[model samples]
Target: MALNYDEIVGKFDKYIFNTYTRQPVAIKKACGAVVTDVNGKEYIDCVAGIAVNNVGHCHPAVVEAIKRQAEQLIHVSNLYYTEQQALLAEQLVNLTEMDRVFFCNSGAEAVEGALKLARKATGKKEFIAAEHAFHGRTRGALSVTHKEKYRKPFEPLAPAVFVPYDDADAIREAITEDTAGVILEAIQGEAGVIIPSDGYMKEVREICDETGTLLIVDEVQTGFGRTGKWFAREHSGIKPDIMTLAKAMGGGFPMGAMLAREDVAANFGRGDHASTFGGNALSCAAALANIEVIKKEKLVARSNEFGAYLMKKLKNLNKDYVKEIRGKGLMVGMELSIKCEDIVGKARERGVLLNCTSDSTLRFVPPLSITKEQLDRTVEVLDGI
Candidate 1:
């Protein structure tokens, strides 16, 4: 018999780690903003692989680039340089206005690198992060992550202080001479798209300058036009000492990077940090192609335009449970008076995949390439729900 969803899920139940709370559908293929399940069900993928598919799924350019690179050089050690890595690094440095780039395999790794770099540069061991912040799952990243449940299991992590988001005064009060850096998300993605107030980031930058502390901004979820800019920090017009990027960096391919200015980056010498498979030719090709698509298609502008459209449509929905609608670019979120897990399940059954984060927030991180018609359909499905 042909493979089915139940059989596949059964295999996962038996063999895979029970770490993720997965949805019921077993996706067979995805393209643009739609996914097809094993049972032949089609869905408007509002998740966009959790904001990874910025250029859309299996984009022809990204696919072709990966194929071409695989045919030439797929993997290479950091001891030696590959043209793909060189090209990609230069492109990243140019786009981010950073002096250097450190490649990694995931957002967690990027956060780890950024943390390590900040410590090395500042000769301090403590980090100050915002409450409800989520950097990643690794020990160092988790240390700064503000969720008690996630941190409780992984106790005795690194030293970090949690303060209120969008509150510069709390951060200033928390920082001490031992504070290596202040790590923050430009927009709190896992915390339900908590956008900072105007000048908050700039105020933090000034404080960091005054105290001689490094500022590390985690753009893992909001970068690559997720928030209508190449990076959300751009909106605040303040550059951090270090920045981490991932999610949409590779046109749906798994890749991450930590970037820093020349002076701050110079503290870490060669061999201080390295990733064996980081910036491998194959991943670099996908990332390079992904960036090209974002530029050629002007997805940043599209994200800004469509994001306003999506938020406007959502604000008009006749749902009493809606507490708030917020986001920048396509990274929209709807905070409900009730828990959103049930709403997510209901949305999935109706062909629009939704993500429920922070328990009560419905996060919409669809691809930047999604159409206005698709956007309308997504809202209509939610309205029906």
Candidate 2:
């Protein structure tokens, strides 16, 4: 049966929480790099659910894995052990070069867990975070997010000091003796794909070591091949003491995790922290399959190559409006001198999908499986817009 898109949207407006100002179109189906709306309008999905569908929508391996896991066992509470959960944890630990993994449900939850670990390990109350950093939406994560508009409503947040990004000296000044952790995104996602200065991460790593501050890298947007590397921090040749991952890690399923070194993870004993549905069998299966597909297809390397191509094409659009083109791999951003909301809407009307961040910046987080032709089409639409 076909869905009544307008009717459903109207009903949603009436009944749903007014949290998001949604786009008018209703996306009903997606495969590979394309999505079709309920009105039969097809689009080249450059957004990729803001980088969630790293293997593209419904890769056969992931779909089959989900089906098989659903038939076997959908979920088992954290009280009991499951093969899928253990296997996923082991795989993630190995992939992240970390000693332990804590499964949760979303990026915010993983950030929360990482925060808890850092405080417990260091026995400190304050934290240091980068300016324009976006960790998550929960209270603890929100405290460090750095954006005043999002934090104004919720005051008296955790004790976190904000330092200017890409500035090692600012970080040095911010990390006091009472600071438990220094957390930041490898590449600023919500702040419009801002990459750190050269050797910035190495400096951060060294400073954290000196201060006994746990370096927690938030890879929620840059992980799982979105930034062309297995993890964006690898591009800088630095390993964080703890890492928070979500988004593409579960292949569109709801799953988040924190990977930490053995010594740091020792802070949390049994009954210290737990989630009811964390590491469920089905989510674990999806994550394992997603990792397998990412490896088998060499999507990470492809992201690097194709991302260079896309950046080159975007540079050609450096007309009166575009101020800068910056990014790592498929996580590209175009900063405009003016607001980009209208341009994004115009591109969407022309059968291309994109998202805006920071109002004036346009973000392109295409699926890792996106082809050159799709990118060309997106470029053409953007050029016209």
Candidate 3:
């Protein structure tokens, strides 16, 4: 049975929630950094499923692990002890400084868990987050997210204060007795891949230490070697009390987790929090395989090298519309003076799939497995535009 793109689109219009303004092409399959649409057209995938396919689409090891686990045990719930879940938690704790992990289903759930953990541990009511920082869309996550448009419709969100990003002084001024936690994205992803100034994270760490405020860093989009480092916060040489992760954690499987220091994690007692399908065997197995692939392949170093190459090629273009080129590792963004929606459409026509964020910023989050040659070809396409 041949699939019909038009029929699928029509069905989506009729049945799916009107949450996303989707791209015209319907992806049928992907491998490495290339995706084939239902019509059999291939495009160099720069979006990488919005940074979810860090190890690349259908990585053999990850697929094998998922298959093996699925055949044995896919779901036994969190109520029972699963070796896969326990091993995945151990792998996560080994990779990070955090002492414990709470698994969930998405980045939003991880942020939600972190918020609840912070409030419970510190016994405080308010949280301080940076302007332009995007955490997630759930109620607690939405409250800390700085964008007004996303937060406007759902008014009366959880109590939170917003400060200018990278402003150490403003953070100092904002922190008070009521502040339970200071949440921030090490590099602002949804807000145009904004990177903070040198010493900004260090200063924030000091402030949190002095004020008894828990620092929670959201690594949902930047983790799993998407950045040069294992975690973006490692670039600053500072550790947050809690870190939220998801995007690349379970390969292509839906998964999220909040890693916290021992004392903070201990705040939650038995039956404090649990997700029915949070740490299922399949997701855990896939995650373990994902981590193994990243470590064994040394994708972190590759991201740094290829990311620099891509940035250099982009900067050399010196396009009139290019306002700035900023980002860390493969998570680069080219901010343009004009609206970039048209440019994105043009790129898609040229067989290069790109994404636009914050209206004018062209986001590039290609798979860590993308080749230098593929990236060079992508640059050639952009050069023509």
Please name the candidate that would achieve the greatest lDDT relative to the true structure: 1
Model 1 RMSD, rounded to 1 decimal: 0.8
- Per-candidate TM equals 0.99, 0.99, 0.99
RMSD of each: 0.8, 0.9, 0.7
Candidate 3 TM-score versus the reference: 0.99
**Over the full model, what C-alpha lDDT does candidate 1 score relative to the true structure?**
0.95
> Residue 326 CA error for candidate 2 (Å)?
0.6
lDDT of 1 at 78: 88
lDDT of each: 0.95, 0.92, 0.94
**Candidate 3 per-residue C-alpha lDDT over 1-385 given as tens digits, one digit per residue, 9 for 90 to 100:** 8668999899999999999989999989999999999999999999999999988999999999999998999998877999998999999998888899999999999999999999999899999999988998999999999888899999999999999998989999998889999999999999999999989999999999998999999999999888799999999999999999999999889999999999899999998888999999999999999999999989999899989999999999998889999978899999999999998898999999999999999999999999998999899998888
Q: Which residue pairs in candidate 3 have backbone atoms (N, alpha carbon, C) closer than 3 angstroms, thus clashing? A: none
Model 3: residue 274 alpha-carbon error in angstroms: 1.1
Show how many residue pairs clash in every candidate, following the order shown: 0, 0, 0
Error of 3 at 2 (Å): 3.1
